[model samples]
Target: MAPSPVRPRGRGGYWLFLIPGFVLFTVVIVVPFVMNVATSFTRWSGVGTPTWIGFGNYTKLFEDERFWTSFEHNAALIVAMAVVPTVIGLVLSAALFDYIGKKFGPRTASALRAAYYLPQVLPVAVAGVVWNWMLHPSYGAVNAIFGTKVNWLGDPGLALATVMAIMVWFQLGYPVVIFMAGLQRADPALHEAAEIDGASWWRRFWHITIPQIRPEIFVVLLTCTIAALKVFGPIFVLTRGGPGNATMVPSYFSYLNFFEKANVGYGSAIATVLALIIVVVTFLFLRVQERDS
Candidate 1:
């Protein structure tokens, strides 16, 4: 007789648990992505067999001035959504956590956090529509406050910036929550030591708090970049890519081509390009994080 065979260290059934999620991912994400890439090579009317156009769609896309403008608008939005919001959230979170929480209580900090996060809880459409009306030239709250007619959404020059500002408002909450949670993980002794060394609040924040919350910073940056890149709802509801396409981003551009114009091939190419950019950016961010770590 031989010794009894050892059982596997883990449950083979664990993989079975992943099967459902794996299947759903394949159906929803994988299939659509592959099909879109394939469709990008064809000129299709969304009905019959699509004509193979090679890279004509891509060539046209690169030459389209509006496409480049949309890309530039997206880059601007990343600054508004990721850069500005992160800076503001970091300051607010540090103030609430390191100052207010120390003196008053955690409850007050929590209340402030909730207030900051309230805008994020609203449905995107509702937020868009509400802001749309609030920025109306005549009767909107913005005009009402100053008692002047300002076309917040209608003016080509100012419309994109207005949308970007609203994005900053909505994107503020995530970093606050993340940074506050990160603050909780920070060692209290570091603060005490810094204080003993006569470090100023700003000094301590720059030296200690930021280093401790680096992971949260990366997470917020990555997410906000992606969100800003693909942002659609507010642009759709408020500006409708109007005022001569000032607020148009690639996401809306793709939507217009696919649904409104029925140019499936060009739309698919735009979508694929946008997806590729997201993937490349994500990869680069992760690589930088790894190197820094």
Candidate 2:
């Protein structure tokens, strides 16, 4: 009645609070993403004017056998790391959550979990160097210890698989931790009910355990898939896409085009393709999640 006593400026303040974050997002993500796409259509070598060149870069990507091979490699890696690792992590976490965590107590189990998670905390560069040393074909500690002189990173047959091994080893820890956390949050009463019904460990795991942790599995799959798609560091340091380009990934290919070949436009085109693939894969995963839910 008193002219609806002036409303507090809370909504206005909320709007004000969003401005800085919005500006940062626009500047950092939106701007760079737009520019990268724009660069895909131009003929620039990182120095001169970026002359617009229509779809020439895309044309080249399709024509180049190496580019297509890189794409295939990326697909294989995504399957191995994303699908395989997620399953492995889930299984390990489920087993640990079911038996070990209960027996060992949460604090002790957490300490052991951190032990498994050591690789993730270490610098990737250091991991690469260590792997390189361990896989040195002749004088490597791996060969010395195992009494085999297998060239892990030298042969074309083993190079990609070797890189995949490194990836799986280093990346497994994080997903295990995430899955463990998810497993911990699940209702204990569900387990008790299952046990009361005489459900075996494997049956209970297949039924109660997996369904409860589906969300965490989806998260691990998304993250692992993205990481696999962009796997460049260890390959760059350890293989350089070597052993006859057996380990050439999309990201490394893009880096080669941009820096090694001085073909920024073509590199940007490859990057655009990669971005599109990632988007498609992620969207498909989201659909799968929705259906599962």
The top-ranked prediction according to lDDT is 1
Each prediction's Cα lDDT score? 0.93, 0.87
Q: Give the TM-score of candidate 2.
A: 0.90
Model 1, span 55-159: residue lDDT tens: 999999999999999999999999999999999999999999989998999999999999999998988778898898899887899999988798988999999
TM-score for each predicted model, relative to the true structure = 0.93, 0.90
- Estimate the lDDT of model 2: 0.87
Those runs of model 2 whose alpha carbons end farther than 4 Å from true positions after fitting are: 1-10, 13-24, 104-108
lDDT per residue as tens, model 2, 9-82: 54467687789999999999999999999999999999979999999999988999889889788888877777
Top of the candidates by TM-score: 1
